[model samples]
Target: MMLSEKYLQIRKHSEQICEPLEREDYVVQPIVDVSPPKWHLGHTTWFFETFILEAFLPGYQVYNPAYNYVFNSYYETIGNRVIRTDRGNLSRPGVKEIYQYRAYVDAAMLDLLKAPISPKAEELLLLGFHHEQQHQELLLTDIKYILGHNPLFPVYSTTAFKLHHDQTKEREMISIKAGIYEIGYSGTDFCFDNELGRHKVYLPEFSISSNLVTNAEYLEFINSGGYKNFTYWHAEGWDWININQISSPMYWHLIDGVWHTYTLAGLQPLAVQEALTHISYYEAYAYASWAKLRLPTEFEWEVAAKSFDWGQRWEWTESAYLPYPGFSKAAGAIGEYNGKFMVNQKVLRGASLATPEMHSRITYRNFFHPQLRWQFTGIRLAK
Candidate 1:
């Protein structure tokens, strides 16, 4: 597809997510798990305008110069952004004005996409397309998090990501012998900067589960008083649990003492075969240890994932997210993608249903804090 067409579709997907939401729902926040919908809409526009249009388009006009401050997310290279805590207070721009801001930029972006001449410009446009998809996932996640806080427990859509029955079964355990394995994405189409610089790392011999740990399996963990007992948790995990007084994953709640998960589609009985998602890396690790298993190293995960449903869910790994050997970043603000975050985070392989089909790949390394479980995070086991 031409870059313009692709961007149109990409931008549309971001809007499509809002079809089920009302203006009143735009600013909801149950917890820290979500950004306001208005924020997401405005932020993605800031991405293209701040990063691409303002840099390359001659005489490009910003809809509201103040938005440059208000919506500029975290790119410090680009002046100042409106403070995050105040995102909920921007009732002046409201929802309609934000859409107008998006529409104005969408027109300018299409103009620039057509006027672009250099291969570098084209590549960056593709990067923006993927960047928008990332936000589309965030849009759903943030809304779910916000709705989760509300007593009504609103449902966004009924489309299911998993089957009604638990079709996932335990297959023969595959043992990978100790050796060095190549890790990271090597393809050339487009990737987050973090997935570059393919490198090798040593992995110990280990047995990994055939499929993700299912909701049914996790129910066993909960029924066994998994949250009540700190013995199965790491010290940090214990602290996180206590500090937050966390009983389960972010959206999980008890109804008549039975576990039900809240989502964009309201509350439902947890799908038994679907991977048990929204657990932190600390929780994933603790749960693995409880099962007498360990989280797979990223290298081990990259290698084993090549043979399974690597696109289904974000698979947690034991390794902290770090720069690869011989890794170097691109020059300038575009470099903001990944070079800075090469510390104190665990890598999750694969992608979730929320991820655009285009961006999902085996070697894509998504990282988050060990104690964060709100994204579409889940677990696979290593023994």
Candidate 2:
């Protein structure tokens, strides 16, 4: 496929995910990490304008100059912008305006892709698509978060990603032999900068669960007072639990002795056999402790991933989000992407159902703050 076609397809899918959303759903940011769906649309457009069209195309005009302040995320090298917590408060660039912004930028991007470009410009263009794909996943997740937390329990779309009950496979652990292994992306294909600089690491032999922790399994933890018992939680996790009064996973509700949670398909009975998702690192870690198991490090996960089925959920790892030994950031605003966020985050491996096709690879490292539970985060036991 041509580069222009790939770019259009990806950009179109981002819009499709929002098709089911009501006009009002596009402007909400329920938490600090989640950008409003409208913001995602605008910011992704801004990324192309800022990085590709404006940088690569001669005489490219930005659709809106003030949009820089509204859409600029944490890239301090770019310019000053809105702090995250106030995203929901911005109402000027309504949903309609954001869509126009997307159209405007999309035209310029396609025009740029029509002509041959330098290798470095092409690299940035590919990075822009992947970056949008990352936000596409975030778009779905943030949409879920916006709706799931509502008192109405509004369903975003019945067709959105959800699990069907599967009782055919028995849960088992896959044992991996200890060995030194190469980790990180080595291919010429597009990968985020963090995934570059492939290196070697030694992993002790460990057994990883063949399947993710199930809803029924997590139910056991809840019934056993998992949230109440400080022994099962880390010190900071314990504080988080107490302070937030969290008794179950983010969307869970116990209604008249029945377990149900809000989903893209709406509030429904929790599927016991389905993998438990929408969990945080703290919850995953605490549940691991409760089960007397451990979460695999990212390296260990890559080493054993082929032996079992994954990609249903973003499995949290027991690793911190850090760079490889020889990793270095590029010299400009693009350089600020992943390297800056290395400090205070936990890594998740595998891909979620919302993850776009070709967007994830085994070596891809996804990181989030420990307290966030809005994404499709799950656990795979290792010991």
Please give the RMSD to the true structure for each candidate, in Å: 2.0, 1.3
lDDT of 1 by residue, 39-123 (tens): 8999999888877888788999878888888887777777887777777777768899989989999999888877645777777
Q: With candidate 2 superimposed using the best TM-score fit, by how many Å does residue 4's alpha carbon deviate from the native?
A: 0.9
Summarize candidate 2's per-residue lDDT along 244-355 as a digit string, tens digits.
9899998898899899988888899888888899898999999999999999999999999999888988999999999998899999898899999998899999998889
| TM-scores for every predicted model | 0.94, 0.97
Give per-residue lDDT, candidate 2, residue 267.
93
Consecutive 10-residue window with the lowest summed lDDT within model 1: 160-169
In model 2, which residue pairs have backbone atoms overlapping below 3 Å? none
Off by over 4 Å in 1: 160-167
Give the true-structure RMSD of model 2.
1.3
Predicted structure with the largest TM-score when compared to the true one: 2
